[model samples]
Target: MTIPAPTHQDMLAISERLGLGITEEQSKIYAEVVAKSITTYGPVAEISAEDTPLRPAGGSREHTVPTAEDNRHNAWFVRSSITEKSTGPLAGRTVVVKDSIPVAGLPMIAGSNLFEGYVPDFDAEVVRRVLEAGGTVSGKAHCEYLCFSGASHTNVTGPIRNPWGDGYSTGGSSSGSAALVALGEADMSLGADQAGSIRMPSSFCGIVGLKPTTGLVPYTGIPSLDAEFDHVGPMTADVADNALLLSVLAGPDGIDPRQHGVEPSDYQGALDQGVKGLRIGVLKEGFEVPGTQRAVAERVRAAADVLARLGATVHEVSVPQHRLGLDIWSTIGWTGMTETALRHNGIGIYRDDHYPVSLMEWAHRHGSAIDQAPPSVKLFFVISEYVTKHIGYAGYGRGVNAARVLRGKYDEILKDVDLLLMPTTPMTALPLPDPSSGIEDELRTSHPMAFNTAPFDITHHPALTLPCGPGDNDMPVGLMLVGRHYKEATVYRAAKAYEDTGEGAFRP
Candidate 1:
């Protein structure tokens, strides 16, 4: 079918929007020219690819058992028993993929009804690797709506209560991933982290979580925040399990483009190495954030001493720029959030970013459900859109530049120390905020959660969080160990050394 030609009125509107002051006569001429160009191009090609193996060695899995309707922790979107290759490192281990990452044949709600009934016909690279490596795909874990909110209370399935017991938060958007692992519902889970999503929930629920160096684990087939900040890694009950999962998940998929030239690592190789002779820098800014509970600080300091006693040298390191991380991250991250949320609608440039085209088209069909997004996402959409309109995307550019400065500050400190140690969160898990509460209360939930964790997302460093010990009210505190880019092996080793001392144990 030939394309419909644009009317003179349509051309006038387009010209006015572009600041082209063409008169009525010029509008007719320009409209014909534009119509001819569109006609020559024919209809817009469907962005969705057919259901076939796109990446080599991308095996499939049988959805043997269907997802259960409900569960104790409200942590899973779909609970099924699935495995393909039965003999590998992760054999017999049950795992959940966060709902934001595709796992073919399963309903990936992404914690929102906006994508109901939208099942992908292909698996995410990480999901494929898990099946091939003999890991069982247990279910889809809950994430915050569109994986935006850091608080666990924002999911459409229901609020993910903390495993530490009632009333407390299981910091999110990877809410159920941490909750399930912490409560022993699953052995391990894959979590995508844009701004501390994996680590925040892990810290809140007292599990071990690693946000690998960006681009280390391919973001292919996962709904993303932005290509620059996207990452996927493992959340588990212990450092050993986390390391084991990373060994399987890390590597190029040959299709992500971001992973094209990247070489993978043997993450399990240095796990048993003691932290002897290692220099650990305790970040000063990490402890100075307002609202940091006294016990949370004391607990992290005590862990630093434990590393010292275990033969690692520990000292204080200051990076003043870190004080600006939240602001810088808010500017860039929220702006990117808006761009990504609307990108499939042709609202922005398509940079060949990793997105499930089929799932997106399904979402488009059910797009009206987007109004059900929580207050946090609504706030982000409104504010990010307003800022972009007023400031013309220059704020995002400035934010990226500021992030580079912050990354340089971290690099300067890392040059003198093997790893940077800090509290994973400024405070232990706080009580879940009332859903009907005012915006001020809702904002309070995430303000202190990612102060330390978000910076690494910006810098693309490998950061791991593990249980340190109980803090105020017996809530668990996390000791975060951050390593240079692609040095997750060193991060794992330090975390394992701490784990060996039995200081980070949480048997809930």
Candidate 2:
């Protein structure tokens, strides 16, 4: 097959399609200029045999390792378990990193055929922190394909079911991270949340997950959805473990732009402070939504009563804009994430890049991975491409502005309350839908799952989800507490307060 360059006629047609009025002569000139530019810059410089390969940025393992057992739970994509006997805060803990985050020499599928068999040459910042703190690197948890869906079935590995209920969904894209911890496959795990991935699964699986303030935890080596919205945090079976993990992971790595100029805090120091005098604001709109489950809502309200009994005041606070959080998240995420996915290779947002260039190039030879991705990922790309091309991405900017306005509303309310409380998801985990379900069905089931958690991702606030005991069919319910940006200590304090009740964070 011969590659064809764009003709002057093609250029003219494109200009017309874009509503640019240009003469034939101008089109001809611009087409030739573009051809010349491509010819001049398309080829990379040739390397000599003497040239050295890029050195691995961090410590190295002997070689990539594989899982000892590949089982039905499908919770883990790779298992290269490592236990170092050093003593530190996380000593004797075995933790897994979400497949989207790199762990040196471990095969990371990232729950997509797009990244199958890719292994990083270096560990992610969080992985290094866990190892240095004496925690064991158990494996890489399977995530949703491209980390785009809130359902577990979207991954290449099939569904990651809730440990609590055999066929129920483990609210995702951090499915395996929560599943493994909930099942005791690992003591704790690292999860990445772009739009509620961490907290949603934590909610479904009855664990504790924290989406730290945007810049509070460095996102250096995690595969990104959007740098601005990307967050990496800890998921554990209890609040104390979560806080201890957060203490280790929170700090500047001097490389991630998100962590630039940010100071670290002692998260563990304030966790036991309790919510004695803290005022908790229950966001009225969060529970009054159309399909909000009564059982889940009642559990969250009951959780507020528990907090109130612990000496915290619970007030019904209304932030109407909170309802638009899902819409805004969609408007901003669809276009931005589609752009990144279309890039095919890894997005170059972090230092010490570990792009699976060979695997991606090979996959490209067969077909575009975007075209083959699961429904949610495909829908995002197709719709975003059309919307951005024809209707323009004006909504993306408006969405950003709306996020600030929403943040202002929360901040204003925060002036009168210490933290905002709500359900982590609109309902408890739903039964796993059929694989052949329509996109509409998937969207219908998943659209509201992030309503309560996506807002904080947009506003850069610290939000935490802790189990509020069982609800609706005895499935777990999650109560979320949102704090001011970088105020995760307060979020943890309140969560720890609930955990102290000895009723939350159930283990299956």
Candidate 3:
């Protein structure tokens, strides 16, 4: 590929767009200098154009969009069988990967029409790890459009239904990942979290979802909303399976810049250790969030009490700063999405991480079509653009600083407790938004479920959601256990003890 030099007229147009006020003569001079400077890009373009070893090494596999009968809940985007190893820990297990992550030869729509038919040439690091661990890549699970929603209805494919209830949402943007696991279509699934995407859906569907400490699992090859909050982890039918999957996925890949001093532990090995002597903090703010149903809060509290019975020291703890987490998350999330999704074609710059060049090109080609996106995505665009145009990066800057304070507050509590317990979502699976509802209603269903789960994403803590019991409307209530950074083992230990009581099972 040859680099194109800007013409004098092109320079003038660029100057006008940037409000540089360059004179015609100045534009001509600048064009000449830019043309000379771009000669250096020839080699760079040449290297990029050449085929690299980054492309997955394998024969192409066939994939099919599931029929309505095969995909009753609209959980699977595409079903395919891809197994790279014959024997390993995950042998004979099927793993459904969230559509947000790239799997070579499979279309990664991320539940958005803008990315429709865009097949990645390389596999995300987590996907490759799954294959190597002997897990079958059963399919690509559908998610919310551009992965922007906390509720399942925003998926362009259609609302993903919770297996536990008819006409109910499977909280998103990892909606399909949780549904597939709950439906027994897959033994485990991989899910990404920016704001409660994994844990929220897992809570709604009665499955176990772990959002590992940020960077515990390398995020290379996955498009990031924001490096600070982006996390990819395991969603499984049980805590043991979740722990097993995390062990396989955690650690630095030498490609993701988000990882720093990662410490991978024996996730599965620590499961049987009961919560004896463990100190558990029940977050008061978690239960007090507005819209939190009394039934849901009571269910989570009962689960905490059960832990106390199992020899764990349980006590109420308050992190008042937690109340401000949602605002901070929104500020950073909207601004980051604007920079990464809107301006940069879902591939942010200023990172040394692996770039999905082909995916970025495909997104760029269809970027103009984002206007046809779902209401939730449009809401993100509007707020992000508004903040950027009026508030500038100052809002994001303040958010980052506030996040540090929030993290400190949680850390202070964690010093006296091994894990913090809370509700994964304020409520259980909500009724799916009506398809005929206007944009305001659609937007309303998007993010309210992430109140508790979003906070840990910003704090970079390892948080896991396991089914505690059934709540209102017979929907599964998710009890979230948050651990210190890189301390997923402690979270699993406590969760396993609770699960052993058989109380984590949904018994509606």
Task: Return the top candidate by lDDT.
Answer: 3
TM-score of 2: 0.87
For all predicted structures, in order, the TM-scores are: 0.92, 0.87, 0.97
lDDT of 2 by residue, 358-471 (tens): 334443553465566776678888788888887787978887888888889899999999999999998888888776776766665554588888888988899999999888
Give the Cα-based TM-score of candidate 3 against the true structure.
0.97
Task: Report the poorest 10 consecutive residues by lDDT, candidate 3.
Answer: 48-57
Ranking by TM-score: 3, 1, 2
Candidate that beats the other on lDDT, 1 or 3, i.e. the better one: 3
Winner by TM-score:
3
lDDT (0 to 1) per candidate: 0.83, 0.80, 0.90
Q: Across residues 177-244, which tens digit of lDDT does each residue of candidate 1 receive?
A: 99999888899999988889999999989999999987899877777777768889999999999999
Tens-digit per-residue lDDT, 1-508, candidate 3 = 4568888899889988989999998988998899889888768866866645354749976789899998899999999999889999999999999999999999889888889878888888888899999999999999988899998887776788888786999999999999999989999999999999999999999999999999899988888888879999999999999999999999988778878788799988899889999999999999988689988999999999999999999999999989889998988898888788888878788887667788888888899988888877877778887877887899998988899999999999999999999999999889888888788788888889988999889999999999998987889999999999999999999999999899779865
**What lDDT does candidate 3 reach at residue 117?**
74
Where's the lowest-lDDT run of ten residues in candidate 2? 45-54
Pairs that clash in candidate 3: none
